[model samples]
Target: MSTLQIGVLFGVVTFIALFSGMPIAFAVGGVALTFMLIYMPAETVGLVAETLYSELDNFVLLTIPLFVLMGAAIGKSRAGGDLYASLNRWMGRIPGGLGVANVMACSVFAAMCGSSPATCSAIGSSGIPEMRKRGYSPALAAGIIAAGGTLGILIPPSLTLILYGVVTEQSIGKLFMAGVGPGLLLTALFAVWVVIRFRQEKARVLAGDESGATREILREEGFTWREKFETLPRLAPFIGVIVIIMVALYGGWATPSEVAGIGAFFSLLMVIVIYKCWRWPDLKAILGGTVRESTMVMMIIATSFLYTYVMSYLHITQEVAQWLVALPLGKWGFFVAANILLVVLGFFLPPVAIILMVTPIILPALKAHGIDLVWFGVIMTILMEMGLIHPPVGLNLFVINSIAPDIKLRDIIWGTMPFIGLMVFAIFLLAVFPEIAMWLPQNVK
Candidate 1:
């Protein structure tokens, strides 16, 4: 069979396996192995072995586990709660204030955590309840938290960025820097959406009320300065983790892997000393959780490498690269096509799976067109962030729904529309002003 035909068949089978509820690692690995055995010599075991070893051997890959551990530790600590509380107090006076706080807090939490699920859980647990207490609609609260959680992956120290860099041979540090400005921009956009929505809701409530005024509602929900000050110190440890990781990487003090290790070490220490929340048993649980999550991520990386190896061996990647470049579209057209394809794929696959499966095919095409890989990496991360909030298979939607059971799925869908619009706006902004994603990386180095 032609390499193009083989690539098509492999993609179809893998998509089927993914939707069948099979583990992604096994699905990708099994599909790749099947094709390898059918098309290549049995002696090709070395191919799989080398791919697996090489994928894991990268120094940058170490950042995945370290960032995951740091996120897990902070997710379980009191800092998340403190951060949410402070944001609530400061932003709560506005209409939909608590809902606004949820988005703000998630942005803050995203800086510390890189995974969507952890971000959803950490910010949702604290912010969701507060929103409910403030009389915010459940659907609105859930939608905000779910959509906001995606910021975790778009912001710096993102594990997804690390994985993309490892697979595409892009600079992970530069990718992280590229993500910073776009992440902050999206966060601000979400905040504005929350404020506008809050005002509309408040207007409805005031119109419906005969006895109570808006002032009464404000009096009841306003946060005190003392509440904000008390939570200030709790933010220190989380800030420390971010600073250590960024400063170490940008300052040439440590490589990404070493920074990951250092970040993890600091995370553990902060949980124990600063937060004073980890007992021996808690530590054991944290370790166990870290191992379990890290194992899942590493397995995906290994299997993705195996799949990439088989495709490369089959010359599929090169053929696809040629096909993409041969299209009528110029560089901008190719960029548009790629983003559209990724968004469609996002509807079916996990972000990591999508990154692994597609980057091998797409990166070569991108390089051939002289597209900046660092900028592309940030764009890809933002696109993945959009997928996290999208319906049916959106991971962040499921996360918030699970946490707030009373929230109907439709409400989650309806509530996300404005934020989704903001996300799209942010994407266009980045496209028009590439510097939003490129400036930091360019200056840092």
Candidate 2:
């Protein structure tokens, strides 16, 4: 059989494994191993071992555990709750203030945690109950947290960006930087939608949009100017960590790995000293959680790298890319089609698998079209975010589902529909004005 046929077979086998409920790491690595034994000499087994070592040996991977530690520390300390409370008190009276606060909290936590589910759980646990108590619709309240959590991928210190960089061999720092503009854009768009929805809901309640339904309300009391000022200090630890990491990463004071170390130490310090939140037992739990999460991500990455190597050995990826480039779809058509494919695939596959499996094939076509990879990474990340909110397989939807079990899956899907549209709009915005994602990493120091 031709090499291209082997590559197609590899994809078919891998997809079947994934669909059969096999773990992504095992499925990918297993398929690669099966292909290698059949098509290559036994001596080539060493190639898999070498690829695994080289993929994990890099300094950038160190950022994963440390940043995860920082997130775990903050999560254990309940800073995420305090951060939301403070923002809630301040924004509660505004239209859709609680929802707005949820998005803001997710963005801030996304900066710290770099994990979507963590952000969803940390913020949703607090935000959902509060919003529910305030008479917000279950669908609306759950949707905001579900969709907003996706910012975890687009914000700095994003695990998704880190993995994308590792898989594609792009600079991790620049990819992080590129994510900032698009992240902020999506956040603003979400906030706007929330406020607008809040107004509509408010008007409907006042006008009796739902017969006998209680009016959704903003808390008009319990928080004064003085109280708002007093709550500001609760946020200092989280804000300080952000400032330190941002300065270190973009100010050229440190590499991403070094910044991760600094962030983790300070996060631990905050949990113990400022918040006085954790005991020795809590600290041990945090460490264990960090190890578990980091190990899971690293395993997928290592095995996927091995899988990627096998594809290269068979020259499958290049052939796929060449086939894509040969299509008569032209540049814009190809871009649109790729986005559509990713959105559909995202409904079934998680972001990590999509990145590892799909990126190599599309890269050559992208290069042929003269697309800038840094810019494209940001675009692809947005699509991945869309996938996170897509139903049936969007990891974030399930995260929200687990946190707020009262919310029906259908309602959650309905709630996220508008946010998904905003994400698509975000992609279009970036495509037309590539500078939204490119300007920072290109010009920022």
Candidate 3:
């Protein structure tokens, strides 16, 4: 068969397989194996084995499991609940403040755990029920979390950024630095949207456009400063973890792997000591969750590299790069096209798979256009955040639905719809002014 025919078939069949409900690792691995056998000679099959081995051979990949363990330990602990309580007391005094606080808490928790589903689960567990009881609408409660949870991937210590670093060979520390500005920008954007929605609701009530019960919510009871400070000791340990990671990375005191190791150990220790999660089962649960998540990511990474190998062998990668360069579209035009492709791939595949599998094919074009890998990494991570809130495979959406079973899937979907636009606007802002994501990474010593 012709190379073009092979390339087209590969995408179509892979899409069908991925969308068919099979495990992502199997679907991706299966595609790689099938194509390797049919197109290449039997001897080339050995290369597939070699490719799988080399993919996981990097020392930097160690960061992923360690970070995952840190997140898992936190996820299994009471730190998340404490953090939410602290923020709510301080930020929840205003009408819709709880929702804003949820966004803020999600951003904080995202730094604690780089996994989106973990962020969604942790914050939504406490945030949702609390918001509902305090007169917050179910849609507002669920939507805020589903949208806020995307912060997990954009903020520092993020797995998506780690994976992007691994694939693109960008400086992980610099990438982490790059994420800070955009992360805060998105957090503010999400919070601002919440504030506006509440204002609109209050305006409606004043005009008798809606019910008046929301007025009482608008007059939410305020907490004293002392009360706000009281919850800090409970949360200080978790915040300390974030500080250690930041200082370690920014201070140049440790490599990404070393920082992850230290952070994970301390996070585990903090939970055990402060949260008293010392029982055998608690330890077992944290370790087991870490292994499960880390293994799944490793499996995806392995198959994605193999698929990348086949793409290169089929001349698909070279063809695509050349095709991209041939476009009359300039640099900005390329960004537009690339963003669209990333969004579509994100809808079907998780960020990890897309990063590993797609990056190799497009790297040449990025260099040709002189696009900053760090900048592109932040953009890609933001797009991945959108995918987590988006449909058929929206990981965060399902996470919210699972935790808050009372909130229907449709509502969660609706709740996330606006944030998608917000993310798009973020991408726009970053594109127009690259400094938003680059300034920190560039200026920091």
Candidate 4:
């Protein structure tokens, strides 16, 4: 009967609806309406319409579709192959070179695409086959792609960070800037893990272990300087896109929305011009996919506003915050518990849904503890990044498996475990230093 009890009951119902095969937008919106009609005054029904309209009216949200469109165009084009070709020419001679190149390519592609599955699909389609050809195990190849792909949500221009910014009322640009350090940190960790795996496998191969026996130890010949230079042109379009977006954003030349539009246009233009692989069918498919994906994100955003509305009216955030703050757990103890809960949730939920659903409930507590929203955005994005590589619901694992069907899902999951550990290590670094994520955002003009 009390507001808090009703709010808690509504949350339970919403989750049940989600697990029972209802769409997230529908589940959240339907539960919210059901509860509002029962508990809120009839005169307050207008709040639902107002909340829906205002949420969709946001100018920043336009970036979501544009970024999705840009990613679709790039992913549909030859950029992935070009990226792998160029990087492989340089890195292929190193131990586990193709895997290293895969991580690098994913990081670069993440900057351009701003999506996990897109990065996984685009890179894995090319990288997995190449690594397999070089005698890399299918599991290691698929795992690298799956884990590397998660950078899409943590790198600059990330949709996850954008949504987090919108939900927490933080600056989107600052969140993007904050993501760069952590993104690169994860990339380094993954790359290092690849090298360590390479060494271990090499030692096993020398010991006559069957599993590692067929693995290639080195490239037959290093590329000539001329050969290396020849491959560099393939990456020009990708590099140009990254430079334009970064300079436009950090140099104060444009807003995030404006840059997203520019990036989308340039991505399409590159596919048609530089790649010269454009076709009417591909364009149609890209647009169709963009429409579907963007619509899903928009619907969630629109409905989440209603959920936020109900919570606000009921003062649920305040009550929860009071409870959390009253706990005997200190700041560190509270964060440890929160991180564990998020990691568990990461196994079951999509990143966008997690942000929309959990953020409102947790923001008040985080704010009460003086946790900086921008810093927490980076931390939360990393955890969500892990979710994309986590098994069962780790969407990127499925994406990679779909691209490289010969590799078993469990093998891919196994390969991802080490990277998952690296991600956790990155989180630990963020927790201890804080400034790793905060320094840039705070120092930026």
Candidate 5:
């Protein structure tokens, strides 16, 4: 078969496997193997081995496990709960105060934990219950947590940024720096939406005098500043971990991999010594969980390698790149088209899968058009953030809903609309003013 025909077949097989509920790693691996066995030489097996080894052997990939372990340890240690409680007490008096706190807490946690589900699981566990007790509708609570969860990808230390840097050979440190401003911008937008919603609710309640008497609320469950300060110390270890990693990376003292190792070590130490949250038995369980999660991610990476190999071998990526570049659109047109395509693909594939599959093809076209890669990475990360909240298969929606089963899927979907609009606004800002993502990376060090 012609290489083009082989590429077409590979694409079809990959789509089928993805929608059929098969694991992404296996899907990519299986499709690649089929093509390699049928069309390539039998000795091509060596190439697969080489691809797996080379991809996994990277120093940067170590950061993934370290970041994952840090996130898991913090989650299990209940530091995140403390952080949220602290914020809640301080912000709770404001209309939708708890909701605003939820977004703020998630943004803080996202800086430390780069995974979306981990962010959702950690914050949703505490934020949802607190908001529910405060009389916030489960839908509103779930929606806020779900949307806030997506900050995981846009914020610093983002695994998605790491993967994008690794795949595209961009500077991971620069990518992390580039994300800082945009991440904060999105978080601020979410906060504004919360405040607006809260004000509307408060106005309606006062208009009807539906609010309970102040003494009644005080007697029932008054706000407590005392608990807020008491909970502040519990966040120290997490803060320490983040500071160490960021300092190490930004100070040129350590590579991302080395910093990840340091971060993981400190995280383990914090859980065992500082928090006293994990004993010997709990340590074993945590390790087991980390292994399981790491293995799943690694498997996906391995399979994606196979898929990338086959696509390259068939020249599909090259053909697509050439085709895209030949189009009449200029740099801006290509940027818009790429964003739209990624948003569409994100609905079906995980961010890793989308990045791995499309970037190899689109990046060449982007560079040929004189686009800034760091800027593109930030834009893509924001688009992927949107994907996590989008319908049909948004990972964040499922995560929050899983924690708050009382929330209907429709409610979670509807809540994200405003946040999604904000994200689109951020994307436009980045596109029109590339410096939003580029300025820091350029000026820093």
Candidate 6:
């Protein structure tokens, strides 16, 4: 069969497996194993073993579990509550203040916990209801959280960025640096959108209110200077954790793994000290979450490597690359097409799987087009962020639905739509001015 035919068959079978509800790791591995046996019959076992072992045999991979642990410790505990509560008190005095505060909290939490669902869950739990109580429409409240949570992958110490760097053989630090600008930009955009959306919702509420009950709900119960300052003590530890992580990365004080460990340890200590969550159940929940997430990610990474190896051995990736480059489109046109495909793929696959499986196949074409890998990493991370809030596989959407079951899934999806547009606009801005993502990575030591 032609390499094209084989590649088509490989993708069809893999998608079928995935849509049929098979786990991603097993599905990818199964298709890969099947193809390997068909192609390398006698050498299938050896090839699979070798590829799997070599791909994961990196010290840097340890950072995944440590990062997961840190997020889990904070996310599974009261740290998220503390983080959100403090921000809420400070931001609650103004119109749409809760929403602006939610965006800020999500951005800071994203830096600490590199998991999108975790950030969504951690922030959404309190943000949504509080917004609801404060007369923020349920859909808008849900949307703020579902969208803000996506920052987890675009901020530094991001898992998706780490995986992208590893798959593309780019510097993890540079990828992290590239993300900082876009991350902050997206955060600001989310906040701005929240303010706009809040005003719209407030107008509707005021117009529709027959009684003053709705107005009362929208009323701001002001916090005193002392009350706002009281939250600072509760929030300082989480801030300290973020500062430590930033210092570790930008200061060149430690490797990624070391930073992950330090962040995890401190986050754990904060929960235990503040929440007194030293019970075995608390520790067990944290460790259990860490192990499950780490194992799932690692498995997907391994299977994706096996899938890549199969494609490479069959010359499918090279053939695809040649095909992509031969298209009549110029580099910018190529980017538009590639971004469309990545966004579509993001709708179906998790960022880690896409980073591992799709990146290898596209790397040659990307290099041929003179695209910077760090910039592409940030761009792809934002695309994946869209996926996190988008439907079908929109983890953050479901996370919001779970947190605020009173809010319908459809409404939650609607809520996140505006934020999705903001992400697309962010992409457009980056395309027009590449420096938005490149300046930090280029100028930083």
TM-score-better candidate, 3 vs 5: 3
Q: lDDT per residue, candidate 2, 1-445, as tens digits?
A: 9986787688789889999998888988898889889988899987778878888998889999999998898876678899999888888677778889899999999999888888898999999998888777888988899998999988989888887887778988899999999999999999999999877777777666764556555433246898888888998778899999999999988988999999999999888987775677888988999999898888888888888788888889888888899999988999999989888899889988889788877988988998788888888889999999887888888888898998899988999999999999999999899989999899987
lDDT value for candidate 4?
A: 0.86
Ranking by lDDT: 3, 6, 2, 4, 1, 5
Candidate 5 — which residues are off by over 4 angstroms? 1-3, 206-228
Question: Candidate 1 or 2, higher TM-score?
Answer: 2
Pairs with backbone N, CA or C atoms under 3 Å apart (clashes), candidate 5: none
Select the stronger candidate by lDDT from 3 and 4: 3
Each prediction's whole-model lDDT (CA): 0.82, 0.87, 0.88, 0.86, 0.81, 0.87
Candidate 6, 1-445: lDDT as tens digits: 8888998998898889888889999999999899988876565667678789898999889999999999999899988888998988898776788899999999989999998899989888888888887777777888888888899999988999989988888888888888999999999898888777777766766678623344344555578899999998998898888889888887889888899999999999988988898999999999999999999999999999888888998988899999998888888988999999998998898777788888987888899999888898888999999989887898888888888998889889888899999999999999999999999878877
Model 3, 238-265: lDDT tens digits are 7788899889888989988899998999
Evaluate residue 39 in candidate 6 and report its C-alpha lDDT on the 0 to 100 scale.
70
Q: Estimate each model's TM-score.
A: 0.94, 0.96, 0.96, 0.95, 0.93, 0.97
Give the lDDT of residue 18 in candidate 3.
88
Q: Whole-model lDDT for model 3 versus the true structure?
A: 0.88
By TM-score, the better pick of 3 and 4 is 3
What's the alpha carbon RMSD for model 4? Answer: 1.9
Which residue segments of model 6 deviate by more than 4 Å? 209-217
Q: Which model, 1 or 5, shows the larger TM-score? A: 1
Error of 6 at 165 (Å): 0.3
lDDT of 4 by residue, 1-445 (tens): 8867876787788779888888889988888788788888987787778879988998999999999999998888777888878987788677777789999999999999899999999989988888777666777788899999999999989999999999998889999989988988889889988877877765676667747346665332367778888987788888998999999998878999999999999998888888774777878978988999999999999988888788778777668767888888877787887788889998888898889978888887787777888988898999998899886689998898788888888889998898888989999999999888888877876
